[model samples]
Target: AEIAGEYLKKGSQVYVEGRIRTRKYQDKDGNERYSTEIIGDRMQMLGARAGSGEPREPAAAKGEAKPAPAKKPAGKFDDLEDDIPF
Candidate 1:
């Protein structure tokens, strides 16, 4: 909740690492319901905080929990126009 309450703004970018979890529950009406959520084990802010260039670090919920260090993206990027034939 700390991360969401703090850095997760409408346009803020974020990187999340975690697992998908689906659970069954009931709402106010007591009707059966299902919720699928990403249980973010670690989350990192994508860019710098507003009005500053220093990037914000991740916030950890677990004990002794500090945010994960800034790391390179695990995914690969494809060449955009470089591979295109003119």
Candidate 2:
């Protein structure tokens, strides 16, 4: 939720990479319940924030504009090893 609170505006675009997780807990009446959520590992802000009035480009283009440069990953997983299971 930290990313949502910090960067998720009404109309902003974001690219996220993570896994889905589910948690189980008991309710007030002792009933078991489950909740599923996405645990984001990396998040990238795309385009302008809400109300910024900037134009967004198509994710894929045939021959118009060049691709944007890659950005460095944020601090969270900068030092993580690249032996990801996937």
Candidate 3:
């Protein structure tokens, strides 16, 4: 929450990177227990200031473009073979 409060700006989309951390603590009965949290490593701003609510992909380290969509045959499924036993 603290990291979000610090880095997140109003109407701006933010992405955070962190690792899970588990720590031991003492309860009221003096029993040892553990709690987990995400320790932030890095953060980035992606979305626009208009708050359009569109999800943005995470930034690549090398700023590489995503792979193009695979191509499909023009023929329909009905044009294919039917080897099934009905």
All candidates' TM-scores?
0.45, 0.46, 0.45
Predicted candidate 3 versus true structure: per-residue lDDT over 1-86, tens digit per residue? 77667756677667677899899999999999999988878777776534566666666766678887879858988997898777
Task: Report lDDT (CA) for all predictions.
Answer: 0.78, 0.76, 0.75
Order of candidates by TM-score, top first?
Answer: 2, 1, 3
Per-model root-mean-square deviation over C-alphas: 9.6, 15.7, 4.8
On lDDT, who's better, 1 or 2? 1
Model 2 residue 30 distance off true place after TM-score fit, in angstroms: 1.3
Per-residue lDDT value at 72 in model 2: 75
For 13-57, candidate 1 gives per-residue lDDT tens digits of: 888789999999999999999999888887677777898879876
Backbone clashes, each candidate: 0, 0, 0
lDDT, residue 47, model 2:
81
Off by over 4 Å in 2: 1-8, 48-86
- Minimum summed lDDT over a 10-residue window in model 3 is located at 48-57
Residue 26 lDDT in model 3? 100
Q: Report the error of model 1 at residue 78, Å.
A: 20
The predicted structure with the larger TM-score, 1 or 3, is 1
